[model samples]
Target: MVTPGSPRGIDVKIGIVDYEAGNLKSVETALRYLHADYFISSDPSVLKKGDKIIFPGVGEARSAMRILSERGLDQFIKDFFKSGKPLLGICLGCQIVLKSSEENSTYCLGLVPGVSREFSVEMGLKIPHMGWNQVSIKGSHYIFRDIPDNGSFYFVHSFYPELDKSSQVIGSTEYGIEFSSAFSVDNLVALQFHPEKSGPFGLKILDNFIKGAD
Candidate 1:
């Protein structure tokens, strides 16, 4: 098994699953900028060999789930989480980790106990909450280790996860209402914001994740 101090000869393989729906390129660029050893693949075999898995998405939940099902990625993702390795989900990717999503009434990976619903546009709010927003971090997590408190991160999403208090919510943000911004529980972790586009603070979070991975 891999550990923090595993042999230096062993290179950690980070697998970013390509679901053909999201900003895959940008996520790859971010990892490249960090000089992280990673690979992009849709193959379950490659994913099974991943030291850590990052699921990034940006599109309709139903359509994304359809693609996942068609490619047999649904079961692969479930098994990836079951391996107890680090898993980071960004944006719509984060929504799918829960039990279900109101966006298209789709069932999700059910790794986390929660449901995602669309933000009320009737509140005179933007349909997709875009641009930079500050994240109010709650508990101490390794992911945010060296990041400053109340740091701003880029976000673009119409739906957000409604989490149970026991879910170990580590951060939150305000956009018409307070919502879960990030969470972690044992080996499973997720972020509602795009760390790849969140600038320096975001990179620090990624660094923390990479460093903490076994």
Candidate 2:
């Protein structure tokens, strides 16, 4: 469990995984605002040097997976997760951790046991669920300890993670349907929304992860 602490980015080195995915700079921008020490890299070796890892991604799953494979980051992420350190997933980072994505039937890292599914068109919502939405906390997870129960966060995705174990879910949100917006397993904390783009509350989430969640 995470305890109360000041921002520890000076002590904690964060690694933001880069695989040519979008939104890398925005995440970096957030870390910078928090005065966190971080580096963006595609090299597995450099990423392994980080005390904490932030996997943020955007764009199609197929191409993302392809880039990860080409750079051998696919196996590196799997290995890193087993190390049991603090790892945060944002947006595509949340979806790609699953076994596969419905987007082109692309196989993912399978770090979490589930699949990413597209929102139903019949729901009459936009294909990409953009803009702000409220995320309801499921339990007392440290990642959301400082965040309000139903805080609004920025989101820009059509696919959502449907985990096999509901016990792992830490947060949920409603689009056309209720879905897993955030989940945690061991040291991994993942959110389908873009916390970096969500303003103060979002920065708090990052601060919580960086300073407290170990």
The candidate that wins on TM-score is 2
Compared with the true structure, what per-residue lDDT tens digits does model 2 show for residues 110-199? 999999999998988888999999999998999896788999999999899999999999999999888999999998999999988998
Model 2 CA lDDT for position 134: 97
lDDT of 1 by residue, 59-107 (tens): 9888988899888888998888888888888888889988899998999
| Predictions in order: lDDT | 0.84, 0.90
User: How big is the positional error of residue 61 in model 2, measured in Å on the Cα after superposition?
Assistant: 0.5
The residue ranges of model 2 lying beyond 4 angstroms of the native Cα positions read: 1-10
The residue pairs found clashing in candidate 1 are none
RMSD of 1: 4.2
